[model samples]
Structure formats: C-alpha cells, structure tokens
Target chain A: MENQQQDAEPEDNSWLQSRVAELENNWRTAMADLDNLRKRTVRDTVQVRQQERKRAAKELLTVLDNLDLAIGHAEADPKTIVAGVEAVRAQADLAMSNLGFPRYGDDQGEPFDPQLHEAVSVVPAVGVKPGTVVQVVRPGYGDAENQLRPAAVVVAKAD
Target chain B: MENQQQDAEPEDNSWLQSRVAELENNWRTAMADLDNLRKRTVRDTVQVRQQERKRAAKELLTVLDNLDLAIGHAEADPKTIVAGVEAVRAQADLAMSNLGFPRYGDDQGEPFDPQLHEAVSVVPAVGVKPGTVVQVVRPGYGDAENQLRPAAVVVAKAD
Candidate 1:
C-alpha cells in the first residue's frame, strides 16, 4: 500500500497553472489506461481459466475413458482384475494431481486434524488415543493455502 | 481517443493557477494505478499457466500409478492381465478427453484433410482419390487447433 502511494508522484505540479490542460490530459489518459487494463484483466482471467479447464478436462477425460474400457474387460477375467482396476485408479489420481491437487490426508498413523480431515465416524480405539484418526474413509487433497478437498475419516472416540 | 480530447472542454482550467500544484499529484496517482494494473496482468498470465500445468500433471500421474499397480498384479491371471492393461489405457484416454483432447483422425472413410489428417502413406486405390485417408495407424488426440499431438496416419495414393 505504501509503495503504491509513493509512485503516484506527478513530476511537475508547481507550474500546474500553466499546463493545467496538459496535467489533466495526462492524468485522464493514465486513468483510462488503468480502467482498460482492469477490464482486460478480468477478461484474461476468465479466458485463462477456461483454457485450463478445457485442457484439464481433456486429459482427465482420457483417463476416465480408459478406466471405463478396463472395467468392461475386468468382468471377463477375475484373476488380475483388481490390479487392472488399480492401474486405472492410479491414472485418475495422476490426472487430478497434475491439476495441482496433490493428494494428502492418507497418513494412516497421523493424528486427526479438523483442517485436513472430515470425520465420517467416531470409533472406540483400543490402543489409539482419543481425537486420533482411527480410519480414513476417503483421502483429502492439497495443503492449507490451496485446499482441493478434505479427507473423510473416522476419529477415535473420547473416554 | 477522440472522445477523450473533447472531455476537457467540460471543465474550465482557468482557475487552476493556485491549484496547479495538484495537477502533478493527480497525474501521479493515475500513472501509479496504470503501472499496478500492468504488473498484475503479467502476474496473472503466469499464474494461469502454472495452474494449468499442475492440473495436467496430476491427472496423468493417477493413470501411471494405476498402470504400475495393474502390471504388478498381471502375473496373478493371464486372462485378466489384458483387461487390467486395457482399463489403464481407457483411463488415460478419458483423462485427456476431459482436458479438451479426444481421440481423433481415425476415420478411414473421411477424405484426407491436410488440416486434420496427415498423410504418412499413399497407396494406389481404384476408387479412392490420392489424398483420401486409407488408414490411421495411430489415433491422434485433439485437433490441430490446441491439439496434443497430430495423428500418425496413412493416406491413399493418387494413380
């Protein structure tokens, strides 16, 4: 904030009376540029997002298509079905991670955190301390600053 | 530009002799705003691209992980092995498609289009024209516009 204010210094206002017109013109021009930039920024942001969405969508869609195909074939053979399914699942996860959604909240022994975990149920743990995550039903994603989603989990019941 | 020049006529600058000093201040303020917006736009563009790359990477990673898992389990059953591999492939395709890239350029009946189809081979055909696409060995993802990759194909030869 302070830096921005300092930059607003006009070079020569002491003789503004002589160049009142000029000063006004300069100021208005700058203002108009700023205004135009504001509008452009908004437009650009939308465009950028749309481009990203399309690109991301295409990549992820490919994964989904492959997964669907694999699922179809899985019914034919049961021996290595899980393995194939797991591979497809991995692809899906990778696609998501590429989108800046690195997976988190999968720590089995980590303590329960409300910020990272969504409590699905509270179960009595025989050995684990209360308030600890007893189970993670679904994993969460991202970090504190750019959170994608929370991990669904079960916390230990309090004594 | 023309409209802005006329705007000055609405206000009289004759009285600004004493307040002429403020002209410099106003100009400065406007200039500062303009500068700030320019910087913001540049920053925004970069951030957008970064986000896009991250998203793309994540989606692909998931598929890779699944593939890894599937291959490990392939030994369990020969019959189900292909199913697992196929599912992984489908998942990849879906992911890409979701990102705005779908499998394309595999049509054998469609005439050869330089814009969409690349001619890798030209076989002499009785009815087919020289430029007609006869076979597409490998499918291309996306179109030439924002396409991920061009389809490697074979086209009919002109007699």
Candidate 2:
C-alpha cells in the first residue's frame, strides 16, 4: 500500500504542474489579445470618422455643383436663377437628410418643446395655444436624440 | 524515511492544487475582460460615426443658410444674385476643406495624374506636354488618400 501511494503521488504532481502551465499560457494569450484589440479600436475609430466625413462631403458636392450651375445661368436669365437657387436649397436639404440629420422644425402651430425648439420671441397669437410654436424663424437639423441645433422659433405668449 | 515522505507528499500536492486554482481564476478574469472590450469597441464605432456625421452636417448648414439669403436677394437686384451665389459656392468649398477633404484638380497646366483627374476627352495642344491637363471639366474633392471622386478633365493627347 505504501509503494502504490508513493508511485501515485509523483504522477498526480506532474498532472497538476501541467495544468498550471496550460492555464498560465492561456492567461497570457488572452492578455495579448486584449492589447491587440485596444490598438485596433483606435485605428478603426479614425477610419470610421474619415469614412463618414467622405460620405457627407460627397453629398454636399452635388449642392455645390448646382450652385455653380445657378451662377452660370445668372447672366442668361435672371428670373430662372431664383428657381435654380431654390432647387439647390432643396438639394442641400436632401443632402442633410441622406446624412441622417434631416431638416426639421418648420412645423407651424405645433406645441413648443424645449428639446426640439428654441423660443427666440414670445407674442400673443390669435387662435393659438400659449407655449405653442407660431413660426419657425430658422429651421433646425437632426433628430431629438442627436440634434445639431434646436429650431429657432417664435412662440405664443402665455396670457 | 517512508513516514516522512508520506507526510511531505500530501503537503506538496495541496500546494500544487492551490496554484492550479489561482491560475484558472486569472485566465477566466482575462477572458471576461477581452469580451467586455470587444463589446465596447462595437458601441464606440457607432458613436464615432454619428459624431463625425453631425460635425459635417453642421458645417453644411451654414452653406444652406447662405443659399437661402442669396435666394431672398434675387428679387432686389438680379446681378447681385450671381455674386451671392458665387460666395456661397466658396463657402461650400471652405466647409469641405474644414471637414478634411479639400477641393483640388483645377490646375490648367499641371501634368495629369489618373489618381486625381479623370480624362473625359483627349485634345491636341501646342507647347504643352502630352498627358497634361488642358482644362478641368469638373473639380474633385478630398485628398489622394481618401478621394471622393477624381476631377473630370480634358487631357492633351499624345501626337
């Protein structure tokens, strides 16, 4: 019985040693993976910003081209230039929409919400509720969650 | 001697078993960290893209506002509308440059490079090298590293 016990002890020790070595290797490998992932995240962030900028710039280029066309036509027909400029404005709005920041806050008679509208002036308005947006002085862009700027508005005065 | 060896064997075995347990715990902790980092990287990528889009969109809004101003002045003086539109075009160019994609490819006498200019038509030229850009049909945006589109050009043909 003593001989058997002595023989089994060395084998058990060797098995435990191998397990410790394996676990140590695994821990080191995981740490290295974490380091590499951190480096890649930095690089990917710059890449994503560059890509988004390029996309938005491309959309703006169409508006620029239309503006050039309007300027070119300005001498030939002054009346058409207004229509051409309006078309370009629409194109710019489309560009903003395509970039996920659609133009907003042109709605009249809507209830005023500070999250979406900035009241520039308050006046008593007929047939309009107090704290309602009577007019949008300047339209806003983007959604409620990621607004670039709140809509400039004239709100009805509280009577 | 056998009794002493028996007593020492159990002590060594227990120590080895403790070491294995500690190493296993460390490995699991490292794996969990890696998993958390991977999830964070995904969230960060979306955030970076949205932030970049918002920045570019904000720059474009100024150009849109200028367009609106130009349209509003169209009725006051027809000739002033041309100059107003031209200024707006310059503002759009500035917006693109601010976003890191400057306008390029309007050089008349520069040697044409396929990376920056696309040859729309080949024309014979006097006192100019072959493959030189005689005229830029349309300008390009962005740098060589991340071009939105190449400039459309009329290149001098080889004689």
Candidate 3:
C-alpha cells in the first residue's frame, strides 16, 4: 500500500502542478484585464454623467428662457399664457426628475438648511418664526446632495 | 586626445544601449496600458450611456403617462392648457434628445426613405407623389443604425 501510494503521488503531482500553474497565469491575466476595465468604467461613467447633465441643463435653460418670454407676452391672454408657462415648468421638472433628479422645493416654511436651500433674501417675518423659510424664490431639482440646483429662498429673521 | 575619445566612446555606447532598452520597455508598457484603457473605456462608455438612458427612459415613461392624463384635463382655458401641454411635449423631446436620441420629425412632403422612416399607413395625395411622407405619427429618435425608434409615418400614394 505504501509503495502504491508513493507511486501514485508523484504521477498525479506533476500533471496537477502544471495545470495549477496554467490556471494561475490565466487568472492573473483575467484579473489584470478586470482591474483595467474597472478603472476605465469609473472614468467613463463620470464623463457620460457630466455630459448628460450639461445637455439637460442647457435644454432646460432654453425652455425656461422661452417661458420667461411667454410670461412677458401676457396681453394676448394672461391666464392661458400663465398656464402654458406652468406647464412648461412642469415638463422641465419631469425631464430633470427622469434623469434621477426629482424636483424639490424644500424652501417653503422649512427651517434654514444651507445644504438644501440658498438664501436669496432675509427679511423679518411677522407670523413665521426666525430662521424659517418664508418663500421659495426658485424651485430646485433633485435631492439635497445630488441636487441639480439649490432652491433660491427667502429666510425669515428677527428684527 | 585619441585615447580619451576611445574610452568615452565605449562608455557612451554602453550607456546608450542600456538607456534604449529601458526606454523601449517603458514605452511598450505605456502603450499596452493605453490600448487596454482605450478598449475598456469604449466598453464602459457604452455601458454607462445605456444605463443613464435607461434611467432617463424610465423616468420619462411616468412623465409621458402623466402628460397623457394632462392631455385629457386640458380644457382649463385652451391657450393656457395648450401652452402647458406643449411645454410637456417639448420637455419630453428635449429629454430624449439629451440622451443621444434626438427627435426626428421632418414635416410632410419629404421623400420616404426606408432607413429613417417607417410607414404605418398609405393614403392618396393630390400634389404629393407616391412614396412621399404624408405625416409623421410618432417621431423617431437617435440616428441611422444606432436608432432608438423609427418614425411612425403615413406615406402618400398615387391618386
């Protein structure tokens, strides 16, 4: 039994050793490829996301500017034009939201938050408490951290 | 002077030989890295773009569904309601465009090419020749071989 075992051991060892060495080489090559791919993916994702955001932002700017112009043409029909402008705003918001940036207007009556809100005006509030948001000057899109734009706001303060 | 030159020549040749070998190795490694990175970048760019487009498309689906609803509720002063609806439509178009799927809606009378236009219905026309696009039903997105959708259109037929 000892002779048989000894005879079998080296016979199996060489073949297995060669197989293991071949596998190790293949594995290392694959791992290097995977590592390179991962690094490249990170860089590409950043570039694509930045490009999408810029394109969306530029489009939004055009629509918003057009809405502003429509608002000026109020003499034709105030209610209709205003409704149209609101509709355009909603569409813009939907586009941003669709791009993983849901619309948010956290500036109305909420406590002052620098992270989410941008203070455009600070005025003493008669009814509202100090440091509370009095109004949202411009609505914002998306969440606090991933926000496309911060809400331009009016914060209340003590006289 | 001749002896000094002879000594310097050997030293210079040895240094140059070693430097050239080192530079060749470095250049080869860098070139391999660049090629690998380029290939990986292309794969990653496609993946990232598709991921972002899917995200945008998912978001747009809800907005598009909502716009369909809004279209039903569009009796709130025709001009205003229309303005709102148009804005929403424009926004959706812009969103698709931003995602590398630019809207394609060439007006009536353009010659129908099978590549860009998909004929849904055929109708007789007075002035328009057969195979001319009569109307576009749903706009196409993306361009040529990379098209996301083909234009659902009606082609004019011989009267």
Candidate 4:
C-alpha cells in the first residue's frame, strides 16, 4: 500500500501541472483578445462618424447645386428665380428627411409637449385651448426619440 | 523515507491544483470582458453615426432658414432678391466647410490632376498648357485625403 500511494502521487502532480499550463495559456490569449477588441472599437467609432458625415454632406450637395442654378438664373426672371428657390427649399427638406431627421412642428392647434416643443412665448388667444401650440416660430427636425432640436413654438395662455 | 515522501507529494498536489483553479478563474473573467466589449462596440458605432448625422443636419438647417427668408422677400426688388440668394449661397458654402468638406476646383488655370479633377471633356484652348483645367463644370468637396467627389472639369487638350 505504501508503494502504491507514492506511485499515484507523481501521476496526480503531473496532471495538475499540465492543467495549470493549459489554463494559463488560455488566460493570456483571452487578455490579448480583449486588448485587440478595445483598439478596434476606437477605430470603428471614428469610421462610423466619418461615413455618416459624408452621407449627409452628399445629400446636401444636391441642394447646393439647385441653389446655384437659382442664382445663375436670377438675372433672367424674378418670378422664375422664386420658383427655382421654392423647388430648392423642397429639395432641402427632402435631404433632411433622407438623413433621418424629417422636418416637423408646423402644425397649428396641436397639444403642447415639452419634449418636442419649446415654448418661445405664451400668448393669450381666443378659441385656442391653453397649453396648445398656437404657432410654430421655427420648425424642428427628427422625432421625439431622436430629436435634433425641439420646435420653437408660441403657446396659448390660460384665460 | 516512504512516510516523508507521501507527505511532500500531497503538499505539491494541493499547490498545483490551486494554481490551476486561479488561472481558470482569470481566463473566464477575461473572456467575459471581451464579450462585453464586443457588444458595446456595436452599440457605440450606431450612436456615433446618429450623432454625426445630427451634427451635419443641424448645420444645414441654417441654409434652409435663409432660403425661406429669401423666398419670403422674393417679391421685393429683383436685384435685392438676387443679393439675398447670393447670401444664402455663401451660407450653404460655409455650412459645407464647417462639416469638413469645403468646395474646391474652381481654379481656371490650375494643372489638372486625376485625383482632384474628373475630365468631363478635353477642349482645344489657345495659350493654355495641355492637361490644365480650362473650366470647372462642377466643384468638388473635400480634399484628396478625404474626397467626397472629384471636380468635373473641361481640360485643355494636348496638341
């Protein structure tokens, strides 16, 4: 029995040592993977921002082109230039819409919500409910969840 | 001697087993950290794109506002309306510049380079060097390092 016990001890120690070596190797690989992932995230974030900027700017280029055409034709006819500019305005709106921030807040008599509307002024009005948006001084872009800016509005005052 | 060997073997086995357990724990923690970082990178990439879109769109809103103003006064003096439209054009250019893609390629006598200028057509010209840009049909935005689009140009033909 004494001989058998001593013989088993060496075998057990060798197995344990191998297991430690394997785990240590795995731990170092995991640490290296984590370090690499951190570096990649920083690079990807900047790339995403630059790509988005380029896309948005590309959309606006069409608007600039139309504006130039309007200006170039300005000396030809005053009425035609106005029509060209109106078309350019619509193009600008479409560009903003395509970029995921469609124009909003031109609606009159809509119930006021602080999240989507900024109360620029409170004015007394007949037949308009208190806390209702009587007028939109400036339109907003995007929805409540992803708002760029709240719509500047004039709210109806309480009687 | 057998009894002394038995005691030392158990001590060695216990230390090796403990080391294996510690390394396994550390390996698991590193793997978890790597997994979490990967998930965060995906979320942050989307957020960076959204933020950049918002920033670029915000700059364009000023252009739209000025366009609206120009249209509102279009019925005034025709010369004044032309001036208003010119101002709006300048604003649009500034907006593009602020977004890091300033306009280029309006130089009348610059040497044409394929990286910056796209030759729309080659035209024979008097006293102009071959491969020189005679006219810019359309302006480009951004530089060679970060080009949005190459400038469309009419190049002087080689004799």
Task: Show the colliding residue pairs in model 4.
Answer: none
Name the lDDT value of residue B106 in candidate 4.
Answer: 74
Candidate 2 wrong stretches, greater than 4 Å: A1-8, B1-11
> Taking the candidates in order, what DockQ does each have?
0.28, 0.52, 0.06, 0.52
Tens digits of lDDT, candidate 3, A1-159: 222323333334444344444555555565577677777678768878756644543444444445545555645665556465556556656666656667677558789888888899999887988999899876665576565557789999845
Cα lDDT listed for each candidate: 0.67, 0.85, 0.62, 0.85
Rank order (by TM-score, best first): 4, 2, 1, 3
Report iRMS values in order: 9.6, 5.1, 15.4, 5.0
TM-score of chain B of each: 0.78, 0.87, 0.51, 0.88
Order the candidates by lDDT, highest first: 2, 4, 1, 3
User: A-chain TM-score in candidate 3?
Assistant: 0.56
RMSD of each: 8.5, 4.3, 13.2, 4.2
lDDT of 1 at A17: 34
lDDT of 2 at A135: 94
What would the C-alpha RMSD of candidate 3 be, to one decimal place?
13.2
> In angstroms, what RMSD does candidate 1 have relative to the true structure?
8.5
Query: Which parts of model 4 have CA positions greater than 4 angstroms off?
Result: A1-8, B1-8, B75-78
Angstrom error of the Cα, residue B54, model 4: value is 0.6
For candidate 1, give the lDDT of residue A40: 85
lDDT tens digits, residue span B35-92, model 2: 9999999999999999999889888999999988887787777667878988899999
Model 1, global lDDT: 0.67
